[model samples]
Target: MRVAIVTVGDELLAGDTVNTNAAWLGERLTERGVGVERVVTLPDRVGDIARVVNEYRAEYDAVLVTGGLGPTHDDLTMDGVAAAFGREVVESEEALEWLAEAGGYTADDLAEGTADIPRGARMLKNPEGVAPGCVIGSVYVLPGVPAEMKAMFETVAEEFSGEVEHVASVVADEPESALIDRIDELRDRFDVTVGSYPGDSVRVKIQGGEAEAEAAAAWLRERVDLKETGE
Candidate 1:
């Protein structure tokens, strides 16, 4: 399955906060064998979130949106997501009960929009915070806070799964330029994707079906003096 990730925050654009949510989600999703097709960061603008969510939903199998899910004024992700599907944002009684029970705060004591969510969306419990995330259609809305997002994702992690590719990595003593021809030959001979990272030493990564990846790794090992193996 291919998924798109959308992160909403003005702080991210201003370099006040790092966009680690996207990277973490990408790694987790990739580990589950799901291909992350796109990672987009946007300001906490309803229009931009709506447009991107609308567009990505049609293009990808699923869209995972994070950030702008707090009770603050800049938290406009839900509004934009609601607009994407022509849905209304309404106060959810179930969510209110969750917030009250989990956070020990009554409805009156909470923020104005604490329990507001897109109508018809399934609320996702946030184990790490009071503001719950939700799922609308093919889009899974998640909190921006790294801790809350990671905890919430575990609740629905089983929903995303695909064919897992085998991965093998090796560190070679040769320079990157000197390995291009061999890398190309390996790709031509095996049904695997190869990546070469240049540093003090070249690190080559091979990914594909188990047999193909193993074969490709072995092929590379025979030609290049590998310093490290199996990453």
Candidate 2:
């Protein structure tokens, strides 16, 4: 499955909050065989969030949106999602019940719109926090809190499964410049995607389907003496 991740927070855009959620989601999705095509970080504005979510939903098989699902004023994710679908925001009884069980809130308090959700969206149970996630169409709304987002994602991870990827890597103590031709040759010869990282040693990572990845690795090994980094 192809997916896009939308991380919503002014703090993230301001560099106050590191965008670990995007990285984490990318890793988790890849491990599940889902390819993450894009990642977007936006301020907690209803229009911005809605526009991005709507755009990605049409472009990708699924869009995982994180952040802005709290009780605070800036938590506009839910509202943004509703606006994207042209749906009205209404107090969700399911979310209100969940919040009541989580404590610190009464049914009447939640009735005042603390547990608002987009009409016709399915509620995603949030075990770690009060704000429940909701899925409207292919867009999966999630809490911005790392712990909460992780938990909610795990609950529905099966839905995002896709073709399993095989990864192979070549590490060389030589500079990246030494392997440019060989890397280009590998790309021309195989269906793998090549990624290069330069540091004390240069690392070339190859990713593709199982047989293709193995063949690419073998080709690279035959052409160059790859360093045995054991990484």
Candidate 3:
């Protein structure tokens, strides 16, 4: 499975808030065998978020959108999704009840449209906060707050699970330049991606199915004195 992650927040762009959501999602997605093709960080602009979400949904199998679901004015991720799909924003009864139960605030006490989402969107419960997330089409709209987003994501993470990727790595004392041709050969022969990183030692990462990665590893070991990095 291929996915794109969109993190929305002015604070993240300004460096006031660290953009840990993208990295966390990327790692988790990779662990589930889903390749993250792109990660985008956008300000709380509805049109821009909508455009990206629309584009990514068509380009990738899934689009994981984080941030901008709040009671504040800057919270516009939901609006963006609505715009992208041309769906109307309506109060979500399920979300209203969740908000009331989670925050101990009545629907009337909360800000107007606080529990609203695009029509026909599936409301995703937020175990950690009052504002729940929503899934409008392929785009999963999540909260900007890390704690809430993490909690909300767990409720829907299984939907993204896919085949497990087999990854193996090796480290050689030689520089990456010395292995450029070898890496290309491995890619062609094993049909696996080979990444060469230069440092005090060169680290080559081989990724594909289990058998392919193992074959690539064996090929490298025979050609160069390489130490196994890990599984």
Candidate 4:
């Protein structure tokens, strides 16, 4: 399954907040074998959010949106999603009940549009926070808080699946330049994606199907003096 991740926040665009949510979601989705095609960070504007979500939903199998989901005025993700589908924001009883059970929320808190969701959206229970997320069409909305996002993603992780990629890594004492030719050969010889990073040592990553990745790693090992293996 191919997916796009949309992280919304003005703070992110201004560099005030690091976009850890995008990176975290990317890793989680990759581990589940879902290919993340794009990660976009946008300002907390309903129109921009609606445009991107609408576009990505048509291109990708799913679009996961995080951030801009809260009780505050800047929280516009739900509204954007509703606009994307030409729907209205309505109070969700399921979300209200969940929020009530979660405790610490007064009637005033619930009445603050916290229970409002895009029409026709399926409420996603937030085990870690008061604000609930939802799924409208192929778009899965999530919270900006790292804890809440992680918890909510777990509830729907099973919905996404694709070819499970196997990864093998090896560290070569040689510089990346010295192994460039051999890496090229490995790629040509095996159906695996290879990446070489130059750090204290040249770290080579081989990713693909189990057999292909193993073969590519083994090929690299035979050509270079590997300082370390496995990742």
Candidate 5:
């Protein structure tokens, strides 16, 4: 399935922190055969988040939104997602229980800020931290903290399915310029795409395809490994 990612936070938009979550999640999704079609960054703006969430839902099969699920003021990811789906915020029982335990919110501590969520959203428990995320319509409001987001993601990964398997090999002491053209050509010949990664040692990543995986591997062995071209 095709998916889009929305990372919401002031830190990301202001460049105070690198948005490693997107790249990391994208790679994971790719490895599982899911296509990460789009990645978007937004400030803690409710209107902007709602707009993008609504727009992308029409284009992609799923949209995985991260950031802004904290109790602090700038945490507005849920609000935007809720708005995008035209829903009202309500206190979630599952969330309340999880929050009371996970978020340090007691019965009295379950105030307006900590226990509310969009109506009809399926609760995605946050065991790593407080601020439980929810899935409103097609938009999934996830945590901004990498650790929490990853934890929450692990709990719900099976729901988003499109499984991709990739195979790659390393070519020591080779230039990507020497391989790009051939790799692109191989992309056509093989059922999957070939990408040449540049570094002190080169890496070639071949996309997974049931029909062409073995053949593609054989071809790479011939051109890159067997002769040790050293180009």
Candidate 6:
């Protein structure tokens, strides 16, 4: 499965808050063998949110958005998401019922603001909090709080599944240029996508079948070495 992540928060864009959700979600997705194609953090602006939402929703198989979900002025995620799909917002009965069970909220409390989801969206149950998320098409609206967002994601367990086995490894002691031909060779040999991420070390992600991954692993062990000079 290929997925895109949208982290919505002024705090994150302004660098006041670390984007732990992005990293955490990416790690979880990776361990699940899903490929995260992109991750972006946007300030709480309708135009920005809508642009990103529409773009990613069309580009990737799945879109996951986190933050701006509470009953606060800054929480314009639902509105932006609605605009992205050109849909109206309405209170979700499923969310209303779920909220009542979680916090004893009256219908009034559950009828406004937080419970307002994009029309025709599927409500994603948030067992950790009262505000429920919704999945419209491939777009997912999740809570900002990591704990709550994770719970909401679990509610849609069947949607995000990875069919391919993938793995990554680090190699240093040589320039990344050294791996250019090696990467191409591996791609042709295993029908895998090998990406070279440069930094203090070179992180090569090998994504393909289990047999191909094993083949790539054995090939690398025999031909690749890491001495940490620079790669």
Clashes within 3 Å, all models in order: 0, 0, 1, 0, 3, 0
Pitting candidate 3 against candidate 4, the one with the higher TM-score is 4
What lDDT score is found at residue 8 in candidate 5?
Answer: 89
Clashing pairs in 5: 32-164, 33-163, 33-164
Q: Scored by Cα lDDT, where does model 6 land?
A: 0.82
Model 2 clashing residue pairs (backbone): none
Q: Give the TM-score ranking, best first.
A: 1, 4, 2, 3, 5, 6
What's the lDDT of the predicted structure labeled candidate 4? Answer: 0.90
lDDT tens digits, residues 166-194, model 2? Answer: 99987777788989999999999999999
| Alpha-carbon local distance difference test for all models | 0.93, 0.88, 0.87, 0.90, 0.80, 0.82
Residue 129 CA displacement from its true place in model 3, Å = 1.5
What TM-score would each prediction reach against the true structure?
0.96, 0.92, 0.90, 0.93, 0.87, 0.83
In candidate 2, residue 157 scores what lDDT? 89
Query: Which of candidates 1 and 6 reaches a greater lDDT?
Result: 1
TM-score of 4: 0.93
RMSD of each: 1.9, 2.0, 2.5, 2.1, 3.0, 3.5
Candidate 3 per-residue lDDT over residues 1-231, each given as its tens digit: 899999999999999989999999998898888889999999999899989999999999999999988778898888899999998888999888777777788977988878889999999998887777899778898888888888888999899978887989888878777887888888879978878887878888898889989889988978886655567
lDDT (C-alpha) at residue 85 in model 6: 98
Residue 131 error, candidate 6, Å: 1.3
Could you tell me how far off, in angstroms, the CA of residue 87 lies in candidate 4 after the best superposition? 1.0
Q: Which ten contiguous residues of candidate 2 have the minimum total lDDT? A: 104-113
TM-score between model 3 and native: 0.90
Better of 2 and 3 by TM-score: 2
Writing each residue's lDDT as its tens digit, candidate 6 over 1-231 gives 899999999999888888899998888787777789999999899889999999999889999999998568889898899999999888888877877877888886543587889999998888887788889989989998889988877777567778646665646556788877877777778877777888766777776777778688678656766746444
Candidate 5 or 3, higher TM-score: 3
Predicted model with the maximum lDDT: 1
